[model samples]
Target: YSGSFLYAIIDWSFGQKCNRHRIRTWNAEQRLICDLLDNYQVRWGRPVRNTSEGVEVRFGLQLIHISDLDEKNQVLITNQWQIYEWEDEALKWNPAHYDNLKDIRLPIKRIWQPDVTLYNYADTRLEEKRDVLAIVYHNGTVLWKPMSIFKSTCQIDIRRFPYDRQNCSMKFGTWTYDQSKVDLKFYRDIEKFDLNSYVKSNEWSIIGNRASRFTEKYDCCPEVYVDLKFFISLERRGGFYNYILILPCVLLSCLTCILFWLPPESPSKLVLGMNIFTSFFVLLLLLYKNMPSNAEHIPRIGAYYCLNMGMIATSTFLCTIVVHIYFRGSGPMPVVFRKVFLEWLATLFFMVPHTNTPEHHESYSLIPPNKAVCGGDKFEKFELLKERFKSLGDKHLRTTNNDPNDENIELTIEHECGQSIEDPLS
Candidate 1:
């Protein structure tokens, strides 16, 4: 039953108004509400005349904002609006009866709505119908739009890391009903989603997206289940990482180039190499700590760090060897070693001879005033590098030993100019 005396007054006033909006007085709206709910045939369960002909629920989603995507937990949390539209002939009415009332909003609880849910939900809260309004049109059509925060499980592949792209899917299907009871499909009339309403995410960007309808039969149940899957291709926003992570890693890796330029015997070479290696280790540790522990594939940035760390370790080891050999007392340089390394390699590297003080020139010099040391020299006297060392041993020993004319000298000592002969390590 509708309202009494007040309904009569409102019904009379509604007939006097010609305005489209004013046509629906309190009486008109209340009469429609009473006619729809007061019917004993209307029930709360499924609003359909026959169970054999299933009601098709045209459902879609509008992504408003990306709240967060947790890599470790492999969950994608999104803020979205759910859209559903279906026909219920049981709720249809004539617009002429209610002063051309085409549409009316009623409590969503008073109607039958699909129990669509994310099958792989990650949140603790269960999916439930919200207390809102569903628009009921005179043509036996209903439209329900509700905002929801969905935490759906998504597989996260971090193999590419900062440059990686991820494909995350949100699977929506009926929680209990089978395809025979409730069929799901995309709405062709409405724009799939509002692109203008989407807020730009700080860490991820949508590159590609697809919506699909999947129908499958479970092993335990004879009936097939229908679902709509929305796959979103998200590319990580690398601008922040480019500066904070990639740039620093590249700069630290470039520091390894300095090791080759340093002197072979200098201790700083090994020290610098070790320092760069330590930096790489620290970076790797930080990346590992932040990443999912169960990740199967290694990240590109991690591999890059490992490659440089290996180089630094190898170079540091070689540097240690070179410094060790430089300080070792290996008697005199071998004839072949001296010819290849001291003369050929040194000249090829643009190495210049170490200048000696005027006092020590006499000790190492052989045919000093005018000498041809190599093939293209114009000096008149030709003397090889070996002759200079022989002369230093035979000539300087006698001079330093204070023997002017020692004919039967049994020993010879060789040394560089101005260096102390007493300390061997120095």
Candidate 2:
């Protein structure tokens, strides 16, 4: 055999003590046999393929080799495909027909990556397929299958499946098929750890049963999925607090605004204004007490109420000013003060952007007459009485003229032409 290489199909078996490789070739071919016996060593306690009664399952391949059984570098298979091949026959390849053979590579399956999210709980490994939560197996392997389940648990009671009913229906059954199922009897000794329930122990109680089911034939993994209800409660925390605080504040502020409708003529309007101011102050105090003091900005509810009170207070102050100027003097108020108090204030309230309150009204009162306007008429009446008094005095001094009608008398009390008395008419 010149320029020929001989290749043999090697079946390396260990249980029956066999050695078939020759150490020396006459043509000086030295095959290196570096402890070849160790490669096929078999332990007495190791499981072997055999056939018996109850031991048949125990002896026959309970676990298939995931790939080529290289314990140091293990690989898992997910898709079915060819994994072995022999060399193809061609005219130039006759001398080394069996020397090189082609090995088929299959798609790897069930490869797990360590999930850091579950590090605080029991050790967990996740296997994902097509971006879905396929399996979260316990972090170990016995023989070839994952040893996710203990040997004691039975009757798994899943509180919630990984998928909702709609998705579950689309996928499989009442329970979502995305998660792996393991034997229930293998989980009796273990307890599941919940991160949220554990941290919030004072608020929530720990719940749900932790069990196992057959993911494939012998693999079992943890199934973790929470419903939408759990997440919704977490998202509404701020909204709930805001609603509780703002509802009452809005109602009271509206009531305070209504005080502006009280008639300016009524005595009660002043009391109502004072009362509203007190109530506003009290509410402001309450807000400070209940809310966090570190917030430099005001709460939304407080801002709204403050704005309402401001408009109402401005309206009340203007009414009081109008009443004061009306009664303070006998005539109309000075034009400057009237313009400042009426026109400008009216613009501030009625013409401003926030003048949309439903029941606000403009108030005006009339000024009283001045005493100087009627002074001359009062003086003329006084002068007529004085003339009667003087005539009575002269009656005692001289004989009175017996004339009931003195129209013919030429006598008159006359002063010099240039002289004048203060005319009563004036």
Candidate 3:
């Protein structure tokens, strides 16, 4: 009787396997795969075994598209690869008798999926519900593939600006389950996050990527939550900024240097300087509008602009001083002033003196009657006059035998009109 009972148990197991095969073949013939969905209870609360060893939900990502990278809102959109551990009791069968079937397609609503969410999501719409492709094996392992659009928050640091690189991340895990029940694992060996596979972006380029998994322990809950994070490194495509913003600003900066070469007496010098300064101020305002208001750490480009504006302001101040000095007293230039500015600074800066009118030149002509000096060559004539003044000063000292500070000796080189002598060459 015991032998009979053992044989009966073996026969019953074999009969069950045969029945399962028959049912699978019938479903495939009738185009009734949906009926197989009714065979098991898929809406279980937990898909993992109740033990110390938590469920390992393998996760990965493949970038399909980059819809937008909103700087103002600080958000980005991409296709995320969704995966999880599913209960095998709901869907499992032998492949040999079911026409060697290894996979099946089912409406995603028919299976139980983890309630995962992007904690940094910026959109109001919920994740889409779509069909899932399931690959089953003899060992009762199910691989489910479901694709969805993820609009996640990305903290942008534009301090480096046009030449800046950015690192953005996407975090995924069960919203409710603790690490003790369900854990996330990065399938780094089997999956790859390829930058080349992504749709090219106009404003940014993919540089590199990384993946990691960890658990966060909350103060309120004793159970820690598992997290899977993926990082994508990107570099800004700076061609736009180079041509539109930076190029114009740089050209304006170069134009400012021209002001230093302009003649101090010309009204156009001041007008041109003022116009360049105004343009710089406008560019500064435009930069501020596009950048964050945080004033703690200024960008390198911003510092460049500030320095440019400062130089222009310094030039304006120096121009004012030049105008005042040019229109000052009509008397001859002081010996010390002429020696330091006209002889030293003017030569160092390659500044040429403006030529005086014929009437003014005739009054102080130092050249011989037979030699005709080049017109408007005031710098050369000024040197000759400087030497003549020194000689006259010495002769006066020997004749008067008076102190060098005596007003009469100092005023010895008076004009024919009895006025103080003026440096006509300047």
Candidate 4:
């Protein structure tokens, strides 16, 4: 018990001494912050200990969101944060001298950053995050993150169209410096995209991604240059196209098929065909608006619409010919037409040749134009039928004594085809 009491007293004394030391360090840190601005150098140059060896800037990208992808212009817009880390000997300091201050946030202009820029940029403005701050650690390790929106060029292939997937590449490299002066490395040795903070797009989704780094020597310079290429595969969200475009296209195709089933002699059949054709043309125009006109391969959907349109046009022309043949009494029916349409097609369609015979027909005016359409010899039969109708009307007036209300004396026309036209006045 005596030994334990003595140990407790020693521990209390050490704790009080440590508390006083911490208070002294706190004052030192506050005093150091007052001189932080004065020590910061805005015009600092690139820090390299050996002039021959380059300062290696390890960098990576954190993709936040894909705003839009324009197929016509072949441009992709994205929002991302650029992560860069490198050691600067000129920016180093002793942390113990300033109360173990580990890091400080300073305007990026006070230090040197790698001139890494998007190589495949479509938009000219690449350096948009200039006024950002970098976190400077006491050991001279600087960590900088600058957020920027990039518009990069991508080769667009829309042969699959609404269901298509695209692969876009973003290449980052130092613009003016060679590999010897400004070597690039992946931040933290990680190669893939940092999509931990990704916001998904409504029209497209990221399916896959690839990252690679390589150095190349070009003809313009003898020295080699380093670049990091990141590729993202995007797949279209087809639900919108299916409902807005594909569904309507399919329904129009079905209607085009039905146009052939409409009666050949009906004028409305041609009108309906024209309507379908117009609707299909409108859909084609809408599709062209979204796709590039200079595509190499024709899309499957485009070919389908074109073929359907041709079918619609053919149906319209056939309907017009059939209508004209039914009304034209002078032109003799062609033998091929009589054999194919009147005989073969009629049998195939389950139609009887003289199905409109007067025995089954009601009125004298129920003219089966099919016979006249078949041969002009039936004109005399029609003329005789008209004379008989003229005589029947006069005979009916004499029998009824002009009494329309007399039900006993019914007015009727007895045609040569053995059919009667009964009057409603009876």
TM-score of 3: 0.67
- Number of the top-ranking candidate, with TM-score as the measure: 4
lDDT of 3: 0.60
Better of 2 and 3 by TM-score: 3
lDDT (C-alpha, whole model) for all candidates:
0.69, 0.28, 0.60, 0.70
Model 2 regions more than 4 Å off: 1-233, 236-247, 337-426
Tens digit per residue, CA lDDT, model 1, 1-426: 456677567545533424445435557877786667545244456777776888899998889899898888888988888888999876799999988998888766556778888887898895434655889999989998888888988888998898889888888899888998899988763424445579999999999877888998888899999988888889998898787678889789667666655544457767888888888898898788757889888898999999999977876666566555445542454576556655665566554444333234353354442231211122221233334445556554645554432211111112121011111122
Model 1 ranges with Cα > 4 A deviation: 1-26, 40-44, 126-129, 189-194, 321-426
Question: Candidates sorted by TM-score, descending order?
Answer: 4, 1, 3, 2
Model 3 steric clash pairs: none
Model 2: how far residue 210 lies from native, Å: 22
Instruction: Please give the distance, in angstroms, between residue 156's alpha carbon in candidate 4 and its true position after superposition.
Output: 1.4
TM-score of each: 0.72, 0.27, 0.67, 0.73
> Per-residue alpha-carbon lDDT of model 2 for 320-390, expressed as tens digits?
65344323433333566445533564355442211211111010001111121112122222233234334
On a 0 to 100 scale, what is the lDDT of residue 118 in model 2? 15
